[model samples]
Target: KTTTTSHPASISSTTRGLSAPTASHTRPTGPTGPSEPDPGPGSPFFFLWASPDNPYESESTTTSPPGMVVDNRIFEVLLSLPIWLMVYFCHSNVLDLYRKMPKSHKWAFPWLIHLAMGLAAVVSIVFGYARTHHIAPQDVTGNAFVGLNIISNSERIGLLIFAVVALGKIPETIRSLRSLVGRIAMEVMDIESIMDTTEILEVIASPMLLASATIIALTIRDLAKITDLLGSSSGVLLSLVLPGLVYAAIYSTPYLDIKDHDKRWNGHRLGGFSIATFGVGLGTIGFLATVFSW
Candidate 1:
């Protein structure tokens, strides 16, 4: 029998070949330590109303993110509109035609838009004094005014916009809508025809002052949590005087049988009063929740 002895070079080559296969076959180790997840758009609190089952959260890449900040947060947490409104008006091409119109009409649509914005800003400001600890009229005692959510001065501008640039054009808007829907062709209403200066002076402004006085009294202890609820507080107070006006106007409409109408108007006023009452209740609940959260 002829015995063959393996050379050291051949043995080393065989060992190297074996090691290569072993190295390639084994699984690679993943990153060490605790796994970190992506915080996602905006920040950790970006997705309020998060749903685990919602595919959109994981799959969809681009969408308007939910906000924790006041700028992106829904108005009083009831509805989201302001940010979208600002974005669309600022960047959208739908208003291109409006932009190209003659100087007078060019600003007509924009003026209406600005008025609505001003009203919303005013509502936010008036309510800010109530809901926010940082914005109270005068810090009385304790840490009641020192809230968890501290808004900056830039954010504070929302409070100031509406007070100066009010619309006072609710009547105009209603008539415009009626004409647009009811009539086949809408006529361009003149400035005088659109504005009821009489109602602005008589019907709206007086009660607005009254509502302001009442809300100021109520906001003494920061009980205005859901600010948007109080947005219509003034209107509700205004509505309180409307039924009496309806009663007064019934005599003028001689042909129409307004005995039932009078009862209906009474109910309408009661409904408005109830709504105003409920708004107060909501504001109180929200305030308690903010101050006394577990």
Candidate 2:
């Protein structure tokens, strides 16, 4: 009876040692526990990632949608088109003025002034376009765009010099035009000066004719949107297609006789080649950009 009444020693020891579990022991807690801290003003990640602040985490977590960056860049690039057209118009007008000068005056020191003036107009247009289009120096990512901008800037400087020289020659040009006009009028009144006056008039008219043609072409192509058709083909078509076509037509015309005998090619031919090269290069760059872009 005494042996049977004795309690098991193991069970008694385990019950005696055990105590109620504490909060720290029952659950392993975080350093700050389960409570969230209030957000501060300076934390970007807090605003971007946290709940309650921006409940739409699905939308907020997303990056810019596809093509958005490319679309923005293309928009900026295309915005420069009108400004470039303006520059082309100004340059064409200046060229017309230069063409009107007498052949004797073509290589004269004063002709440099006309060249400078034309260049200035071009430079102003380019820089203005760049500024308006937000094509800042910092925006150029690599050698290509940077090179183009540099070339543009150099052209501007060259144009400034040409314009200053041309301005100085303006007085000379006016005097020449007036003298030629008076001589022609005198010849018209007297049949004797007819041949001489005709020759003089021809000299005076050559540059004017060329200048006028150039300006007209510029107006038609750049101002009138003749180039817009080609734009659908490629972005470079904006700069190359219409101008090339117009110049090609001019070179082919019998009236202009722009082609040099010895060279067997015309200014239009050269211009076309140059423009084609530019268009090809631009296309290549655009293709690369499209391919490598994220």
lDDT of each: 0.29, 0.33
Tens digits of per-residue lDDT, candidate 1, 88-190, equal 3333233334435555553355344445444433433323222221111221111211232548875456444532222333333233323222221111122
Q: Hey, what RMSD does candidate 1 come out at?
A: 25.0
Clashes of each: 0, 13
**Which candidate leads the pack in lDDT?**
2
Which is the leading candidate under TM-score? 2
Worst 10 residues of 2 by lDDT: 16-25
lDDT of model 2 at position 75: 28
Instruction: Estimate the Cα RMSD of every predicted model relative to the unseen true structure.
Output: 25.0, 30.0
Q: Please list the residue runs of candidate 2 whose C-alpha ends up more than 4 Å from where it truly belongs after superposition.
A: 1-233, 253-268
Error of 2 at 209 (Å): 38
